[model samples]
Target: MAARVGLNGQAPRCDHIDLLPAVEPGLPECKECLALGQAWTLLLVCLTCGWVACSDDSPGGHAREHYRETDHPVVAALAPETAWRWCYVHGRIV
Candidate 1:
């Protein structure tokens, strides 16, 4: 999907981007799902602390849960070739 752009034709900036960890904490899979013996459809990396969790489409909405509990505002897809980020507060891709 095309990113949402601002009046300047640039992708809209998310304030939470500042919260992204200096070192990306992305994982190949959701450790939470692995520990629970559950299958996950997609993986997301919390930009704030590098918490890896399953996407909302999975059995456990762990990524959303992490945001709910910690108020971490951003996440990025952990899958290969996917370069996009989501801002929970804006409810949109950033």
Candidate 2:
């Protein structure tokens, strides 16, 4: 499905995105990935409780693991300007 984009690639049509809490500031790195000597391409931050985990594409896929263990629901990209958030329950990026 094609998403509506505004002046800055905004997609207000994604109402679920509004319900997701913003990622807490800080948490610059995936502590587990670092400790395990694994490199991550992307990061997911738990909205319910601030926990940073590696993305599914990463070696360990800790982000998805976190959802499985905690069912926290949403996670926003760690990088600025990405403007992407995923809802595990819904299985889509909003």
Candidate 3:
């Protein structure tokens, strides 16, 4: 969903970009527990449950791991000011 600034307030619009659906949604927390350690390079936002995970190429691959444990469906790049998300199934930006 795109963040919109309305006259009176802000609104969130679901752009609905085609992307690969996550294989799983209810994945266990990061096994390596890197989540508790250092900062991450990239953040993947789970469209299914809004769980944020680190990119697969990172130390833990928490993002892809989230997909393996839970079929949440959608994920977005969680970078600052970058609201673009990706769908794994469709391989498109959502």
Candidate 4:
């Protein structure tokens, strides 16, 4: 997969693209949300370690929290229809 490239055919503007896993893992639900007994609207997978967490719009906001704690940087939407990645450091879709 083209880990460094975005849908627009531009390389992501952050250094964390190099940290993506060879294969982004699939997960059924946001583990953090489940643990917190909260509901989530979107799921995101950490590109660095394949961590699954809820989007910022969710009550848990675990995906953004994970980045704040780990500095892992990149996360991709886990929904099959959303083929986009987000860079936490840059605060934009990569």
lDDT of 1 at 75: 88
What lDDT does the true structure give each of the candidates?
A: 0.84, 0.77, 0.60, 0.82
Q: Would you give me the overall lDDT of model 4?
A: 0.82
Q: Native-vs-model 3 lDDT?
A: 0.60
Kindly list the per-residue Cα lDDT of model 4 for residues 1-94, writing each as its tens digit: 5556555777554667766767666576888778778899988888888888899999889989989999888999887788899888888876
For residues 6-88, write the lDDT of model 1, one tens digit per residue: 65676576657765666577667887888999999988988788889999999998999999999999988986588888898
* Model 1 alpha-carbon drift over 4 Å, by segment: 1-12
TM-score of 3: 0.54
Models ranked on TM-score: 1, 4, 2, 3
**Residue 81 CA error for candidate 3 (Å)?**
0.9
4-23, model 3: which lDDT tens digit per residue? 54344643333443333443
Which portions of model 2 miss their true places by more than 4 Å?
A: 1-23
lDDT of 2 by residue, 1-94 (tens): 7776634575435445566665465576888889999899988777767788899999999988988998778887887778787888767776
Clash counts for the predictions, in order: 0, 0, 18, 0
lDDT of 3 at 15: 40
Q: How close is candidate 1 to the true structure, as a TM-score?
A: 0.78
The regions of model 3 sitting more than 4 angstroms off are 1-39
